[model samples]
Target: MKKGLRGLYYSRNEMDEMVAPLKFALVGKFSSGTPSIARIRARFAFWSSKDFSPSAESLVVPVWVSLLNLPVAFFHRKSIHNIACLLGSPLKIDEPTTDYTRPSFARVCVEVNHLDPLVNDIWLGDDDGDITQKVMYKNLPLYCPTCSHYGHVERNCLLKAPKNKNTPDVDSTSQEDLRIILDKKKSKLVEQPS
Candidate 1:
């Protein structure tokens, strides 16, 4: 359920600690309508024992790959081996042979990044040893089967009330004040062409 939030607080507390420094940068003063910062949190849910586990093993995950075009026996063992060596050790290959009747794609399993979770784009080489065909990779993140959302599990969904519900409301006025301040600052900015 949605509810209104408080605008201002005169008391010296956590809010003051966070917002006190930005008084001049914001507006002359913060009032009851001033908005507060907000953050979105996510949770994980487990389905079956066979599902991927974050702590069980390596960080690698399976990624579906497909050749764009200009296919010249790139799915062969030698080519696959060369491609694997260029990238890294392939956890698994979809099929030893390429299905010309289909779209010509391959599924490879690689470790998930432990530091950066984002998967970067890939460039594959053609039979002429020149980088030509761009392979596409696709992977799904861990999500709850109940709500089917990217983050958070069914047990702790926002739709259902929890044991402790104290989501603080952000003041809408502060956001407007911030926008005004930003506009003023932007107006003062002078552009210089090089």
Candidate 2:
């Protein structure tokens, strides 16, 4: 892990064995003035200090977002930062974007609440015309809102209540029965006045 964070000037301390499953806390000091380590890529997951809490408020993660079809005029550092602000707290811009080598998209690292519905696109323009800039998030973590936790979606949530045995499971319902139900709803809607 230390080798992975080569230039960041970080110190590692192994947690007590009682904590179990082997965990190490790495504290890094960045000379760049930003406290974010979002650029670090590793096989393991990196959690912030607040992620240990069970509260939904702690459901925040650093994500890499790509602003697609952005205007070349907005490629400047300040302009990119401003555009990234619409998504979340902008951490840092990717090196390629800083150098303007990759014109396809401007990649930025941002810290956003996982619970919030991510923005798909944003309108950007002045008086001349407006263009829809598509937003794409990379490797966004799966989160179970039901359990207010990360790693799994709501459908596979372990905390979800088990279905009643007496209640029929939708998956087990016959195709004919589903068709009849749909027909009934359509008939009822037809009977109603517009």
Most accurate candidate by lDDT: 2
Clashing pairs in 2: none
Task: Estimate the TM-score of every prediction.
Answer: 0.35, 0.55
In model 2, how large is the Cα lDDT of residue 67? 80
In TM-score terms, which candidate is top? 2
lDDT of 2 by residue, 2-50 (tens): 2221111111221122122213423344347643565454312455454
Global CA lDDT of candidate 2, please?
0.67
Model 2: residues >4 Å from true position, as ranges? 1-57, 161-194
TM-score, candidate number 1: 0.35
- Model 2 root-mean-square deviation: 17.4
| Residue range with the least summed lDDT across 10 consecutive positions in model 1 | 1-10
lDDT of each candidate versus the true structure: 0.42, 0.67
